[model samples]
Target: MSIARPDLPRRLAAEALGTAVLVATVVGSGIMADRLTEDVALALLGNTIPTGAILVVLIMVLGPISGAHFNPAVTAVFVARRELAAADGLAYAAAQVLGGLAGTLVAHLMFEHAPFALSPTVRTGAAQWLAEAVATFTLVAVILGGLRFRPEAVPMLVGLTITAAYWFTASTSFANPAVAIARSVTDTFSGIRPVDLPGFIVAELVGAFLALGLMGWLLAPRKPTTVPVATPAE
Candidate 1:
């Protein structure tokens, strides 16, 4: 039997695959960075910039096909916007989380044979949680702003947002739940303790909700001015 387009299952698959590729690259590059900490500057610029660029391109390329919501928080925002159904959002989130686990596991294989370290050097604490909150807020803000005001500038703006967050956010911008889950598998520089993932993810969801609400206020339509049409000689 032939299938109709925009099918939920098909769209969800796209979300999963896109998220898998993104998280895989993220964790992979981060592993390389962690392993190459001897030169932190070189590692971050080389590994992270490319990852950000890839995300921008992939989202631009795949966003229309699947809404480009590689992050659960992003999906949640779409739900808030009523652009996606809550059931679909839940499925997308589940797919992304599973995809993240798979990608990180692959990175682990490339990094070492020893049982993957359950520890990450970034260390978890109040400071880190606060950083995550800030990072998440920033990410949600830019993403929603672009979606509301300038869908045309999507991938580019998102790329800039992530790169800036990486450069500035203390948590190294775990602005994505999927990326966080993937990081855990590597036990590398990018890894976050499994114990700490929940707090950050929760913070991110909250940030997304806040951003979704603000967008209503920020992008509300301006009152239309009446432009009377001049009557020409009949």
Candidate 2:
């Protein structure tokens, strides 16, 4: 039941490494899916499965090290909750974002494509923005709920939630702001236009805070009552 506490450097390394692989899983699978299939639905299916699978594995492997928070949004929520210190959270966020960029480059190199190209995939619209919000909200909700009620099951829950979100949300659930920013630089199957990044990131932030408030309210313990037990006070 007890795990050895990793030092800050090790924890940050785990976060960076885990997030890099996770982003690679996403972008790599999408590239492979696109190259291997003509059906968009099937390609998305291919992309979704591996991304979710890797997420579960990464969380299971690195959860104890860095809480496996590959998303800045998740880190922010934890910081707000006092579960993570602000400085640590900032480091985790930086590592995740940098790792995501590295992952995108890795995927591009694997595909024999030029890296650091701005995405031309325009994913802008009101419905898309709303979808981003909903997807992020649900993701944070699942994370919070799982951590609260079933800590052991958080990895699987998060993976499944993301997989489902890919299918349900119009924006394909780019729920992580780090991911949204990283994807903007890759002109690949999983890429999004740089212009669209702001809307998605903002929506994700809004959704994260909304979920934080909702989970706090929903999971808050009932306050104990004080009974009047005065003896001889007249």
Top candidate, metric lDDT: 2
lDDT of 2 by residue, 1-234 (tens): 977888889988998898889888899999999999999999999999999999999999999888999999999999999988999999999999999999988988998988888999999999998999999999999999999899999999999999999999999999998888889988888999998899999999899999999999999998999998979968
Q: List the residue pairs that clash in candidate 2.
A: none
Task: Quote the RMSD, in angstroms, for model 1.
Answer: 4.0
**Clashing residue pairs in candidate 1 (N, C-alpha, C atoms within 3 angstroms):** none
**Residue ranges of candidate 1 with Cα displaced over 4 Å:** 1-5, 35-37, 111-117, 224-234
Whole-model Cα lDDT of every candidate shown, in order: 0.77, 0.93
lDDT of each residue in 1-234, candidate 1, tens digit only: 964457787777778888877876786787677576778877777667867887888898788778888899888888877888899889999988887776666667767634345655454777776777777777778877787779898788888888877878778788888878767656666777778888888877777777777777887899999999999999
Worst 10 residues of 1 by lDDT: 113-122
List the lowest-lDDT window of 10 residues for candidate 2: 2-11
Best by TM-score: 2
TM-score against truth, every candidate: 0.86, 0.93
